[model samples]
Target: MTMPIILPRQEAPVAAIATPVGVGALAVLRISGEGVFDIAQKVFRKKNNPNFRFTASKGFRAHFGTVHDSEGLIDEVVALVFRSPNSFTMEDMVEFTCHGGPVVVQHILKVLLDEGCRLAEPGEFTRRAFLNGRIDLLQAEAIGEMIHARTESAFRTAVTQMQGTLSLRLDAMRELLLRSCALLELELDFSEEDVEFQSRTQLQEELAGLQEELHRLVDSYQHGRLLKEGVATVIAGLPNAGKSTLLNVLLGEERSIVSHMPGTTRDYIEECFLYEKTMFRLTDTAGLREGGEEVEHEGIRRSFKKISEADLLVYLLDISLESYLDEVPLIRDLLERNSNARMIVAANKIDLATGSEERLQKLRAATGCEVCALSAAKGEGLEALKRLMSTMVEGLDKLHEASVLVTSLRHYEALRNASDALANAQELITRQAETELIAFELRSALDYVGEITGKVVSEEIVNLIFEQFCIGK
Candidate 1:
């Protein structure tokens, strides 16, 4: 729960349009830092209450008012008041709710600046919240995630993070690391006296247990990624295997051109499809074949790249064709290339006479994986196919139910580094190495974990994290 040792930042009162810049009913302009209320009062005139002073107003109170500039009579507004140490940045804050027209927002923001408020930088508000210890770096990033979240699942996860659930978990882990690091440092201090602050046996046990926990958190990244950025699913097969057809059906739109001719889809078409709580970034790839034209080759190359990066691979097959089993080798190749991606062999065109249960059994036998039989054209048995798609990412729902998940790649990488450092410390301890060596490794692990929650991080990394956020946030 301790604050990070971040650099001191300016306490200048800053202002910015806190809402999206557009024509809307209302636009909110946020101002935070020292002396914000005084700056706001200069631009805002309380309606029929000239005697009302923002300085005299209670925190969280609002005053109906009109804003003005040197030009005069800028716009009618409602001034929201939040006092120092009780606001977002733990500083005096005020928000002007004015007409949402871009011009009005600009005018109001300009008047505030003219009143001595500096323009807020991108994410400066949230940055202040972090710098002032109102929220951790992880929680700050979570706020950005919540704002940009497209799916309900992603939004829910971000909400949990913003609520400091993950922060609490990381803080617990940090406490453990800090305790061990402190003990090791104590051992180093009394090296001359040969005093052991901690037993090597117990230390090794704790390191092993901590490392295991780190590994567990690291493993959650995949499911956590699925929550944050939908599953990268590629629908792949030989030409005319109904890859595009399946995509069109799943998306309920003719997103890709369907043709009897091969290589009709010379490029990949990507769309987002939400099934239950999980989102599938369905990519219909260019049909795979040997010796296609140069242009097709480039498309094929891109297709393979997408396939390689896929989290879920759906190998669609036109089971009605005599050469349908000929696709078996292609499916096997895809499985080999994308071994990390969960796969489903979709036996398409089951409405055709030859599309039979026995053919699906043969596919299952050849691929050593279950086959989903369906007709993308007729849209038959697609519910089962959709269910199979969900099954490929099984445990996703349960993962969503879990409180803690490492959705951010930044967090995952930090955890991985921490785990590596802990492993090194384990080796050093087992080797009966000098206390200083073990302590160094433990500190490295400690800092790595601290980076996630902003306990120990550089100014550059802090800037980089906030840079991704929009100005208002």
Candidate 2:
């Protein structure tokens, strides 16, 4: 790995609330830097030990004390000490645990500031951890992901990444690429001697192997995206087909307005639904029909846009009417246009429809996809629909068990670029290209992989990544 980034920051000791900013039973304020213990000693007085001093305190030791300043005592607190090279930032740090209240916390913070502690910036503490060699860049990003995770799957994936599962794999890849580049460079330096450190055919085999592995990592991005962000599932059909009702049933809330009049829902509504471990971003789109008002036309345009981008399309049909069967051709058109998207046919209003089973059979035979019969209004057949939805994305659970998965778009793009460079190197090897040419390609690939783990990254890119975090992280 390359050396840690050296970004310019203020030299003063930094302090910020370690917990969420709200009234709670307790709150923690952390400060870290050189002379941090000295600063803590200025405002803290040990409860029983009158001679207790932070500078003389051992690491990981906690002292019951009252934090007082020029104005007097702010609050009674527990001061936990972490000596240099042991804390989160790998610096001398102290965390003050006090009663959680806006006013109380603010008073303590003001006292710390008055005693010479600068407020911490957004993500500054984690950035210090990275600069001080406590965690890598990927792990830093994973920490942010863990904080903002919305689903259980997302949380688990983030936790795995933060624990170094993905970093270890990328580091191994870097070693292999670096080894090949060194060999190729040595060959270039001794061109006149006609010396070969390794045979060209053997080098080609190594490059081909790396290329295959890179391809696997690049291809896994799609599955990783589904884990990081929920699947985009769109609900679509003609007006008055109980689309709104189905959306409400799936969400277990009356989120959309149900109506009998066609074109009542001229816009789209979206919500999240979690089945098993998978999350679905369910969107109830405006009904598709022939042209109507200008506003309706725009809504239809947007509905098609959503359908085109969906991972799962639920085409609802009112099986009560024989005319519903006539909509098959439209379904075929949608499938044709979006052949990449998985589809399911939902025959609705079975409670009031005659010969519903026969209609469902016909629909099943016609659509060539998963078909389910349900009465959205009465909330029947919901279990089957949910089970089918879960089965639609069946293999994601296996991905969770894999050693490493790429869930960040930045990582995905970098992997793709690195894989493409390796591909080029492979072709050059097959044709017995110059050693310098191969070495250059190998070096490029190495750098790209390093960028993902912050081994060879720019300060601007680093700032952009850490800026996404909230303050006190």
Candidate 3:
């Protein structure tokens, strides 16, 4: 057995509001530590009693009050107290429900700050919740995810994580690992007696199962990241395809300049939309057309560059035009360049077209991409387009269930490295290499899994994780 690593000890006071700072009905300010209530009482005042003893209050009880400074009353507020070990941070926590004006919130926070509390860093509140044993690292991350989730489906997955679904699954895997480690340690103890703690077949089976589970989790990162972040979609087509109008209708706002002139949009425009619980960043780029002005031609060049990075390409066709000359060749060339990118052939301006079903059929038959007939100007057939986009992004549910989707690039890289090490170790095992080499591979694989939940992480890695968070998470 290896000696456990001793982590650095750094305890500090932290305070921040649990709600957004705005002119609303109320804002919740949370302070957690050994002496949070006493700090609150120093500045808090009740109408009937000039002095209120905040620390003496029973747990979870609310106290009506007006917060004050030396000059005058700052704002009317209600305070809720939670005692140690029973609170979110397992420390004495005080919550202030004050009027939600920015000035009022700042003043209240100032009071706490003056009383020796430090400004909470982004995710500090949840970090404390994690350190205090109320939740694990996964749940801590889930809290942040739930706070920022854009769509209902994304929110639901975060909620599932918060409910311990992910933690429970990880815990099961950890248990198996712990058992295997214990059995390996026992082999060292009984090696002189030539007694087997676990048979070779049993060890192989256990390793295979553990490897399978790790790969599944590593795979889930793909779907998880898609749900967490969003898909980048690029809109490409000839000028006057109503791509701008399509972008506006999908976003429910006129975020882009809409004009009938060809090459009106000379730069890429971006907007975000949610469809079927998934988020998508829609990039409306300059129309791909020949013989444009130099500036417009440069814009078209950048549009193709953006198309290369896109997860999906939406090819718009203006059916009202006399002929779709530019698109047929442009799309064929794009497909040749990016064979893996999902492409959708959308026949725009369907409402204005003159019996364009034949044109739509011709376009669809030529490209062999997913096709949708719609009018971006009239908001026609948009729901169908949205549904198709969701399907393309999520893929078939059956595939997701059958294989693990790697969501985070961090997790994916780690898994790939771990898999490589495992394969090396397996080859060495077949060659009857020394026990130390096999053990090294096992430990390396374990450390890779730990990176996902931040176990045994370095200070630099922790800093990287926290840096990704917003200031007031």
Candidate 4:
């Protein structure tokens, strides 16, 4: 097996409050790198053994001591130690677990900083883990996403990726490609012997199978990306509609200002909500109108711009103004321009309008768009709306498909480039082009695919990837 590349050490002192810094039962300050134990021991005094030497202690051990400064004993804490090469960063590491309080945590961190330990940069710890062979670039990215997971779906997706399902699949594909490359090389050397290392028909069959699998994974990203990042949903309607009320009820908060005044919301207001396992960003936009204040008109313009960019648009209609249902021409134009977006007709104020049920059926039949009748103010019929949003994202049929998905845009882009290159390679092979030309196209395809899993990525890309992570990762 070939050894993977390990990043060169750009060593620096690093320390952070491993535990949150708020008032809690306990907090931990972690320090790792050269002289970790020695520097910690200088400030830590054990009640039992005042002269306790931590640097001389055996690796993978723990000790109890009181952290003292010139002001005397600061706090009694436990220190866990890990020796070099066996630790997370492949450097000596010490964890100081102390009582959780703003003052105590701050004082402990101050002592370590004063003792020559610098504060860790965002994701410095995990970056070290990547450099030390503790995990691969894909796993490192998974860890970062896992930390920021906001919904059950996002959490599960990140966990699945971090657990190595995606990694295992990628590794298997790479192994198959490597085997094919080796056979091709062998055929080049023993052409006169007429030995068939990999028959043309067999190779083509395997290639076809791999390509189909890759396409399936690539297709999955549409839903996977939505699950990870949430869909941009813009709620739009006429003046005095319950768009704001519906947004607050769905988010369970007063995220958008509500009032009886027409065009009250002159600008877009957004908030995120969790519906079952998925996340949806609901934006209550300015009510559509022809004549209004200059500012209100600008808001309407911005609202239209948002509608164009939205993944889903909620065309809200105030049932109380059922007479305005004939004004659907404006909405028809909006939909015509944004033909790619999924539009759902929302009949708001059902509690006030007695004719809403008939109006909803008529609108749905005439516009050929999904319709839901719900009273936003009374919080009635919201469940059906949530279900519709989920369905529009990806039909219920694909909901329970295997959890493995390509969620990274970087991976999606790489797969697309590789797929195009493979198509070209197949064409070349079919023409019986020079062997060297086929090999060159195959090599290009391989390189493009390698970018997806960091098999052939630059150090700059790795740094940018880590930059997205938080500290203490």
lDDT of 3 by residue, 359-436 (tens): 877887877888899988888899999999888877723345622244446656766666666666567667866555
lDDT values, one for every candidate:
0.87, 0.87, 0.75, 0.80
Residue 119 Cα positional deviation in candidate 1, in Å, after optimal superposition: 3.4
Clashes of each: 0, 0, 9, 0
Q: 1-473 in candidate 1: lDDT tens per residue?
A: 99965433449989888898789999999998877777877787898888988899999998998988877898888889887677888778898888889998988888888889888888999999998889999999999999988888789889999999888988988898899889989877788999888888998998888888788788888778888788999998888888999999999999999999999999799999998877889999999888989999999999999999998898888888877778778778888998888788988888883639888888899888769888899999899989888887875445444457789998999999999999999998889999999999999999999999999999999999999999877
Ranking by lDDT: 2, 1, 4, 3
Cα-based RMSD of the predictions, in order?
3.5, 3.4, 4.6, 3.8
Residue-by-residue lDDT tens digits, candidate 4, 1-473: 99985533536668988775479999888888777887898788866886678878777888888898878889999988887777777778888889999899989899999998999987888889777767777788888889888987788888888887887787777777667767776877887786767676766676777687778778887777777878888998887788888888998888888998988998899888888766888888999889998999999999999899787889888766747567578779879878867888888878888767678878888778899988999988899999999889775227536657888998888777767766776776678665556556666667766766677788898889988977766
State in Å the error of residue 411, model 3: 4.2
What is the Cα-based lDDT of residue 286 in candidate 4? 93
- lDDT, model 2, position 444: 93
* TM-score of candidate 3 on Cα atoms, chains taken together: 0.83
What tens digits encode model 2's per-residue C-alpha lDDT throughout 1-473?
A: 89985533324699998899889999999998878898999999999888988888899999998999887888999999998777888888999999999889998899888889899899988888887768899999999999988888789889999999889989999999998889878888899998889788888888778888787788777777788778889999998999999999999999999989888777889898888878999999989999789999998999999999888899998989879779999999999878868888998989989978788888888878789989999999999998988888775445434556788999999999998888888888888788888888889999999999999999998898889988778
Sort every candidate by TM-score, greatest first.
2, 1, 4, 3
